[model samples]
Target: MSMTSILLTILGIAIFVVGLLFSIAWHELGHLSTAKLFGIRVPQYMVGFGPTIWSRKKGDTEYGIKAIPAGGYIRMIGMFPPGADGRVEARSTSPWRSMIEDARSAAFEELEEGDEKRLFYTRKPWKRVIVMFAGPFMNLILAVAIFLGVAMTFGFQTQTTDVAGVQKCVISQSEKRETCKESDPVSPAQAAGLKVGDKIVAFNGQKIDEWSVLSDRIRDTIGPATITVQRDGQEKTLHAVLKKNAVLKKDSDGEVIPGKYVSAGYLGFAAQTEIVPLSFGDSVVRMGDMIENGVDSIIALPSKIPALWDAAFSDGERAADSPVGVVGAARIGGEVMNLDVPAQNQVAMMLFVLATFNLSLFLFNMLPLLPLDGGHIAGALWEALRRNVARIFKRPDPGPFDVAKLMPVAYVVAGVFICFTLLVLVADVVNPVKIS
Candidate 1:
């Protein structure tokens, strides 16, 4: 890569890291604000992990930035209550028992005389659930707002029926030749006097509104047909006999697969694309589609691990749809900055990448696994359910579901996540995804 390209890539990565820090801080802010609003004592609100890089005390909370910029947290006092005998400190012979007690003791390490009423566990179960749920919900709200704003303002690239260019001759897509050869036959579109900028109005007497529908219709039909076009403020009809030719089939990313070819009706014209703003409902519908795709990507992540390993170690071609880590995403952002498109287009694409990242954060954190916000929410809900059932049956109250007991399981989950992250990191460095 050129020096300029390298510089642009570094700049893009820096901007993305900044965006990530802000996102982590924003998520923690949600928890801090809600906890304070509910009269809970939040001692510290720190973004990132490890040693404190910057901090300042404001009111009752000490806000700080940490050295490691991976993730963030807000410390809520009394996250778990003491044992049944009201004992905060206890000794155990078993290692697992010690782990549970250690976690419970840490929860009340800073307990003060007046802090009992302000404890997080003292709040109603529903309120505790909301407090825990607020963090990921904030991310979800931000993702939606960013998506809607970008769609309404910068808009999205949409293909239209207007002709952008006409091929000079009918060349098989598999051949991939730009210039016409000596024996190359004239394209049907050229022979029919079709010009660039002509808007396709109808195909074979059928009114066509969407470019996708028109393209599919043309590809399906190989015989002679009347095509109506709006040219120079006048509607005109042209008759042409489309030829059945070998064309390379493309995947979702619009890249031609090597062995994928289909005999489709060829009209040899490229459809024009324009940035068109969407209505609020349309934008929302598009957002739903993105959410669905994100969920599918997460579900299929494990299946991609083998492929990722191969791409990183063996001589394997990284699939275009391979899962990308932070490093890969940063590289893509750099490529986007250096792309030969309008500046506004670049800004829109960057916004899109950030929005998608936030959406993924929201989804990933909501998984009901320990060490995640969703896991805490699940614990609170289960506690509520257990308490209500006991009350109905006139049984003794089980003070709280000891989430601290699950620390061992949480450690296992954290280990798995760390391993997966490292795998992705290696794959990204070795066989990073490239945009063309």
Candidate 2:
């Protein structure tokens, strides 16, 4: 890498880290604000984990920053109630019972006489649910806003039916050759007298507007076809017999995967791309598509672990769709900044990346697992259900469901997450994904 490239890479990583910190702060702000709104005592609101680097006491809350920049949390007092008798000082012989009692004791360790009313567990189940849901909801809102802003205001790169370049000769995708050989045949587009800057008006009696539609049609049709073009404000027609040729297939991102090829009708032309601003409705639809894709990617993550392991340790090529860690994403951001596109395009791409990251955060945290926001929400819902069931049967109140009882399960979940994160980190460091 050149010095300029190295500097851009560092700058990109710095910007991404800053954005991550802001996102963590934003997520924690939701929890803190909601807890305060519900009269719950929040002792400390810290961004990131580990030892505190900076802190300030304001009223009942001590806000601070931590040394680790991975994630953050807020400490809410009375997250779990004491035993059924409302007494924290208790002991049990059974290991599981001991675990439950220990968790209950620590929850109210700082309990005061007047703090009973301000306890989180003392609130209504719905209020507790809201408090837990608020953090992920904030991230969702941020993702939506960033996506809409980038799609509607900054626009996206779109391919048009206009021709940018016409290949001179046919080249097989498997050959991996850029230059044409002596025996290579002239491309159908070149033989048909197609020129750069020609706007394809129609293809095989069908009106052509979008490049994707036209390209698909051209790829599917291998016989003779009439291509109508508008060149220099004058309409013209060209006849060419499309040839069945080996062509590289591209993914949704328009990147060609190695070892993948499809025999399609060759047009031998590249489409011109432009930054096209989408309408509000279009932007919303596109955002929905992006969200769906993100969900799919998350669902498919576990299935990619084997491939990730292979890439990290063995001599295996990293798939383009491999899961990327923060380091990989930062490297991608750096590469995007150095792309030859306009500055606005780079900014928009970076924003899209951050937006997707936020979206991932929202989804990941919403999993109905322990230590996540969704886990607390699930606990609150379960508590609500239990109380309602008890009331229906005219039985005694079950009281707050002690989520702290699940501490052991939460530890397991955290361990799994740490292992997965380390795997991704090793893959990123060893065989990182590239934009090119």
TM-score of each: 0.88, 0.89
* Tens-digit per-residue lDDT, 1-436, candidate 2: 8999989888888888888899889999999999999999888899989999999999988999999888999988788777767677477787767766776676676666788788989999999999999998899999999999998998888889999999899998788778998899999999999999999989987898988788788889997999999999998999998999987786785545578898999978888999999999999988888888888888998899999999999998899889888888888888887888778888888898899889999989998888899898999999999999999999999888989788778878989999999998999998999885
Clashes of each: 0, 0
| Candidate 2: regions farther than 4 A off | 1-4, 92-99, 168-186, 245-264, 390-396
- Model 2 pairs whose backbones collide: none
> For each candidate, what is the lDDT?
0.88, 0.88
In candidate 1, position 407 carries an lDDT of 82
| lDDT digits (tens) for residues 201-234 of candidate 1 | 9999999988878877888989898899999999
Please report the TM-score between candidate 1 and the true structure: 0.88
Tell me the TM-score of model 2. Answer: 0.89
